[model samples]
Target: MLARVRSTNLAVPRPDPGAGRTTGIDKRPVDRIEVFRPGPRYGDGPGVVGDHVGDTRHHGGEQKAVYAFSREELDWWEGELGRGLPDGMYGENLTTEGLDLESLLVNQRVRVGDEVVLEVSVPRTPCATFQRHMGERAWVRRFTERGRCGTYLRVAVPGTVRPGDPLEVLEPPAHDVDLRTAFAAAMGDDRAARSVVDAGCLPTIYHERLARHLAGEG
Candidate 1:
């Protein structure tokens, strides 16, 4: 199977009754999207133009400019949950096919179609918003245990991306810290956390978290 984008998704606002907040977790497929580096999570918004990001505190920014998930993983979840999980159901901007997202190293670059270049930055951490979105009991714990958290990307080269665009993964960085290891780190694996910190390719948040964890403050 060739690596390509099965769909491009944009946020669809939904009311989070649990938290009394609006969430953009309900994403739906779109024909096309403009991709760019949206500087900081606080001031700037989603890297995909016209996309809505309700929770700026935790999501959106240069490091999380885009989110990509594999269709294979979605299929696995569909069977596990006994329901049809469509493309973009997991709030990913790009529903990709035939890519091992977990194997992608931090700082690895991939070109989408002919234009956009994105760098693998981090793994999508399951959070309260995601749990509420799924509405499954202990969804966060289940997702974390599964450890197929998908990948978050930072826009390196701005351009337009559309459905069916081919994905060209560039050479990986020297570090061996892949998304799986990073996800494990996020899940409190001290060894994995140390590996990610040693890689030194990810955003500062990971470093700070590791520091807090070591200090027994996290």
Candidate 2:
């Protein structure tokens, strides 16, 4: 019903491998972020005031405009891994509390404080970059198996955002497909993949890959 952003994070753009790539996945920290209602073309675009993304092609765009992870989930990982995970550890631009990000359905719309409106698009697929960021062996596999991959959002309205800003769901999708479903689909759950495609709210960047998975082509 109500959620708040615990922190906002961004990276300093680096060549090939980004500066955020730490042997421990330590990312740059920030207190607040300017949320472009129409969010930038991507994390590196003009709309975003100060954030930098390493791989524009894969990291940021309209559909994958922003990445959000749950503070609660991060805490869970802290307990499981017996280590502290601060905000932005997963390269998430927004660290949220009081929302079940993993269960967020595609097409769900959220209003941040009063300025920004965001549409849930898809689940962030864990990658080698993430593994290297965390410096954990089998990190990708463990993340996938846990099924708590965070959600990406498309900007529908632009406004500046800050830590402690409230996030309210403006709309919820009619379908069952959600972040977990998308992650499961990517992890070889044919039924879940088909469900994601059928929901038809997935971002364009993810379309081809998920479609192939659904069709047994990939």
Candidate 3:
């Protein structure tokens, strides 16, 4: 399940000084991550983004380039072509460039051809920084709350992954409960909320610590 990806465009951050706000989104760069390459950005560490004040968050982390796939995807598919998701998101380690992240079920481990292995965690959640960057009148929160935006992934087996590797799905969607689905269901519906919570598939902040979920919370 390998996949090739390209930064469809860059999300440039412009400062909003007159409004006392800072940061904006620009869809222009093809590989914003590579542009931000201050040096070798990958290694055996958590490829955490966010802790910054800009778009295409790949700042302050160890593993490697923390990219966010936008309204693009690998020019190929190895499985189901699910629903249409977001067009542009502000923060992420690897923005599918276009593919759908929701289809990757949580715990349905993905191995980037031994280059990288990450168990699906959840889609990236929007924050104040996102709203500030996008400046779309709550659009940031809406996208995240609605499960359209992609999120973060804590690297389990740290390895190098580029834009031309296959995004192999090591396992299929389990019980139809991927992070994207869980997020969409949990936020507004109590029944779906309970299910997502019970499964601990919700974001770490939204998760409920049941005995079952504890075992896999690693």
- Kindly give the stretch of ten consecutive residues in candidate 3 with the minimal lDDT sum: 74-83
User: For every model shown, what is its TM-score relative to the native structure?
Assistant: 0.96, 0.86, 0.57
Please give the distance, in angstroms, between residue 36's alpha carbon in candidate 2 and its true position after superposition: 2.4
Q: In candidate 1, how many Å is residue 85 off? A: 0.5
Q: Put down candidate 1 lDDT per residue, 1-218, tens digits, no spaces.
A: 99999999999998888878788888999899899989866447889998988887888888888999999999999999999999999999999999999999989999999998999988998989899888899999999999999998999999999999999999979988989999999888998888877777677876787867866887
Off by over 4 Å in 3: 8-70, 73-89, 141-146, 173-175, 202-205, 209-218
Ranking by lDDT: 1, 2, 3
lDDT of each: 0.89, 0.76, 0.47
Cα RMSD to the true fold for all candidates: 1.1, 3.2, 8.3
Could you tell me the TM-score of candidate 3?
0.57
lDDT of candidate 3 over 70-159, digit per residue (tens): 344322211123333333344443545434677667656666544666666555555565555545676655565546545445455655
Instruction: Say which candidate scores most in TM-score.
Output: 1
